[model samples]
Target: MTLRRRATGLALAIATGTTLALTGCDAAKDAASDVIASATAAVASAAQEKMNEIKDGVDAAADVKAGRTSVDGDRTVAEITATNPKDKTADYTVMVNFRDGDGNLLDAVVLNIDGVEPGTSKSGTARSNRTLTGDTTAEIAQALRH
Candidate 1:
């Protein structure tokens, strides 16, 4: 083969190899993105199911309140207070919700405070189910006394 023709062939081979390599990289990136999206959707679905399982008690939400939320080691936490107004001791189940500054729900947790004396207030801490970022606030979503 002529030397000039050999050089042209080698250049063409390198260009083809480079193009194949770039296409492979793009395909790998797309596959990774799809896996990540699937995992995120699964997590969100599980969290929603957990939130839906909670049922509110009659006229008991007014007895529970959530305090300020703060970050603790990548998790959001808040103080929960439950006031027992019944003549007898009561057990309380409280659902606390964590939200961002834009009012988007980040996490929700159920806390149980048992054997609270009548006319007394009991306090507990509610922690997020997963790591949360940015500004977070907490609110009492539901409360039940039994």
Candidate 2:
């Protein structure tokens, strides 16, 4: 038996006032046993809704790791991790868009990661075009293979 844990805070989940922790086999079984009946239904429904909204009828070929945005001195930086699941090497261009509390686009930037090998993951960062105020949300505008 092996156990691995990587914990990171996600802005979207935090914004939604929810926290989801999925652990390895043993811990997963323990978590399953601890959840209340009604809460399970609520979590499933909420997850499905969020998936549909994010996918927008498009299939997700790749996965974006839990991302976080933070104020970096004079600029806001968005960091994202991506996993590529193919044999050949590929380049990914990820657009990280910054939005205001009202869902208005504030500033955006593209994070380019080159030469991602098969079945491997990498981290990339993008800086906001301009300073943003108030509640800022960072989302993956696009994750395309080239």
Candidate 3:
């Protein structure tokens, strides 16, 4: 091949490699939508775990739930539902967050539940430290069935 042709090919390969490397770094962090989706799934899984705990085994499980967020004066309140799916009582830790229209987190709080009876659903609320305005969103950050 000509010397000029070889030089051009090497430059193109280097440029392609550089672009791929940069793109990988740019997408290093999770996107807002991806975070939201994962959080939603986790919250739903917690709820289902509680609901199905009452069943004889883990193989028997059903149900899904969503969290709620509302503005109450100077405090933003977030509520997430958890269930005791087992035949016995249980406890769970739930984390809730308040966000604005742009998906910016305004506040977050952790909630706890004790003595949740079998086959029952209980709601836990987290109040933000500061007030929120404009469009607000509430999501469950984490829920652990204990």
Q: Against the true structure, whose lDDT is highest? A: 1
lDDT of each: 0.68, 0.55, 0.55
On lDDT, the stronger of 1 and 3 is 1
Q: Which candidate has the top score in TM-score?
A: 1
TM-score of each: 0.63, 0.55, 0.52
lDDT of 2 by residue, 36-143 (tens): 223323333333333334332233235664366788876778777878777777776665667778886555455667787889988787675445567787887666
Task: For each of the candidates, give the backbone clash count.
Answer: 0, 0, 6
Candidate number with the higher TM-score (2 or 3): 2
Clashing pairs in 2: none
Q: How accurate locally is residue 71 in candidate 2, as Cα lDDT from 0 to 100?
A: 89
Off by over 4 Å in 1: 1-57
| 27-48: candidate 3 lDDT, tens digit per residue | 5233433444443344434444
TM-score of 3: 0.52
Candidate 2: misplaced stretches above 4 Å? 1-61
